[model samples]
Target: MSVEPKMPKCWRKESKPHKFCPGCGHGLALKALGMAIDELGIQDKVVFGCDIGCSLLAWDFFDVDIVQTHHGRTTPVITGLKRANPDLIGIAYMGDGGGYAIGSQHLVNAATRNEKITAILVNNTNYGMTGGQMAPTTLPNQKTETSPYGRSIEETGYPTQGPEMVAAIARDEAYAARGTVANMRQLKGFFKKALQNQIDGNGFSFVEVLSTCPTNWRTDAKGTWKYLEEEMTKFFKVGEFKTPAAKGEQS
Candidate 1:
């Protein structure tokens, strides 16, 4: 195995506040994460590394320790955190662009090496914090600031299927799943499996969450729900891609 970096101490202060917009999916994702850690009683053991975009807004969401990394670079930080502290539950929370585009190389390598970490990849479709830009996970022909005329197939192609991509490379012992926060009950189950993957000592668990970006999409909150439910779910199916049992071991 390759050498890993050391985990640092938790460094969140009470005065710091989360910067996410109201009704943003990132805030819900963070809430799920916090609930999972709290239920498992591992708040102190979680080391959060949030990448750029709305994900960075989660910097102060949790009461545990936290760290910020450059755009699309949370994978390396999480990798280092796991290697440094085997006991720590290292999580890399990042936006679609940060994960599938700028940080893809790191993501693939991390999965290949079976790095012991959990990555919560938020695919809000459009780039929210970056003025509604098109990301690698942007759906086919999705309109954005740069693609007012719609994304060109010859240039942009289709959005990357992240869970499928990781599952293709993951070892049998690893876990990969897709989930959505459109509803509360489903969200709880998804978050449970995500955190369980970490507790199981399984390597390289991934949860690709199909999220909403109402502000960027220039849609009302109700419209965001409709898109997430009617359209985005069609393109990005949500479910578990890998599991401990399928990995040739008891789950």
Candidate 2:
């Protein structure tokens, strides 16, 4: 009789448990990314670059070659990686605050350069690892340490649409999209496409995944998922912004 092969683990089991709050969204996002790579059969060629903020969790979670970049600098690191070795799949994973606020310049520059890589921005709305401070993506009237009374647009301005905002800088409008992970199905699709962008050698593919920071959002997993579903998607619409064909591929 033939025996069945061993099934691969979820990659979450590889985490060191070094740091990260209870039920942190970073863990789940990293797991989803790994599963996506696995599904696409490209884990061997993926180079994961993680930004500061909570995104650093991905550094320890994946078996791929990892790079720890400066706060908001993961973009350039991944860009350079892809440029130098176009055969490798480069991914820059950054949180909302790190990618949109502090690393905003790098984010735009990468798109402007039209570097072939996958940039995944995880928007949890608040600064999760940093004492629950108000972030650039915080919704209207959202309360946080920095915006105790709620985020004031007149004073602080509104949040940035990282994916849509950067699409203009992109070379084409085929693989860029603003999506979320409230549902497993959507999350799977987002990650799968992100990997495909790299494999296809698309100039740039940006996916802003709206995640839940249970600790910073001040809600448990259930409540956080609800908030991500009902409240978060309202601000960041989900859909593709760019999808142009790569050098030698069909749409």
Candidate 3:
């Protein structure tokens, strides 16, 4: 007899065999998130909002209340939900394009305002759902549909340092971190901390996860791991950039 693989209780049972492309990192990221939710026991109080792009595929990935927003609008939608009902734990999930490009303004304003919401952005370096177009987080010298000749640093500048930007602008009580799908434990820890920060009524929490997109990257299994564990980590360092200071402690 075969035994089913263990899964997070908050994950939808019917959604097994998720819709993400093979070798894609979104599933791993969501798994870590689901585990965090289960461990925290806040499944009922959580409100999940996903943006356009590949991230939108997770609309029914969880058993919690979910909202699918337009491209880059997940942040505002989650913010509105949190403001309207402070008791709810709001989570905004999106891709690099949604968080760094079209929805950048919302991200900036939310961080500056210290919104009590958790924002998770998966950085796969390209617009995964939109034919692998060059995105704000696309690395220099990387090739994509729009950047077929390879990304030019002089023309496009460097990839967006999402966690760094959020940590720099958000208030002292806010939490910011960068995790990778390669390390599920660390990613889950970051997710737990971010959610706890919101549960404690702290300021904004943001986590950027380095993910893989083999279908768009045109890479095999080995190449996907190489890009995610080696190439991507070169530019995007993984670690906690900021965390809430202990009570009576200086920031």
Candidate 4:
């Protein structure tokens, strides 16, 4: 007899053998999120919204209701849902391009307003769905279809520090963290906390996950792990940047 792989109860079994490319990190990120939802027992109250990039592939990844939005619009859509029905646990999922580039304004405004929603952004460094174009989070020396000669820092500037930005702008009750797919347990912990923050009626919550895209990266298994565990961590610095203060403590 063969032992079956354990999956999150909120995950759709029919969607098993997901559509993400081999070695893609979105699956791992989503798995962690699914586990968080299962542990929190808020599957019914969760309203998931995914952006138009590779993140859109997760439209049916979960058994919960999901809204697929245009590129960079997931944040506003989720914000609207949460505002209309404060009981809903709104989660906006998107890629770096969607969150940092096209959707950056929505992200910034939401953080400034301290919207009661959780935003999960997967930073793979490139526009994976759009033929590996250089994105806002692409490293300085990284090369992509649009940056074939390697990204120039002088022209492009550094990668977007997403968690840092969110933590700096969001109110004291907000939560911000940077997690990686290499560490599933830690990533899931961050996801759970972010969701719990929303459940507690806290302000905006954001988690940026460093993920892998071997197909767009043109890397083998060894290279993929090297980039994800070693290279990416150097710049991303996975950790919680900010969290809600204790009950009676100063923020």
Candidate-wise lDDT, in order:
0.80, 0.78, 0.97, 0.95
Range of the 10 consecutive residues with the lowest summed lDDT in candidate 1: 4-13
Candidate 2 stretches greater than 4 Å from native: 1-12, 16-19, 245-251
What ranges in model 3 sit over 4 Å off? Answer: none
**lDDT of candidate 2 over 1-251, digit per residue (tens):** 97643323435344555366786666566666767888888878888899998888667666678898989999998888788888999999999988888998888887887778888888888888788898989988889999999999899888778877776777763367776665556676777886787687656777888887777778977887788889887788888776676566775
Clashes (candidate 4): 0
lDDT-superior candidate, 1 or 3: 3
Residue 117 C-alpha lDDT in model 2: 85
Encode model 3's per-residue lDDT on 1-251: one tens digit a residue.
99998889999989878999999999999999999999999999999999999999999999999999999999999999999999999999999999999999999999999999999999999999989999999989999999999999999999999999999999999999999999999999999999999999988999999999999999999999999999999899999999999788887
RMSD of each: 7.7, 3.9, 0.7, 0.8
What does the lDDT come to for candidate 4? 0.95
**Could you say which candidate leads in lDDT?**
3
Query: Worst 10-residue stretch by lDDT in candidate 2?
Result: 4-13
Worst 10 residues of 4 by lDDT: 227-236
Off by over 4 Å in 1: 1-18, 246-251
Ranking by lDDT: 3, 4, 1, 2
Candidate 1 RMSD to the real structure: 7.7
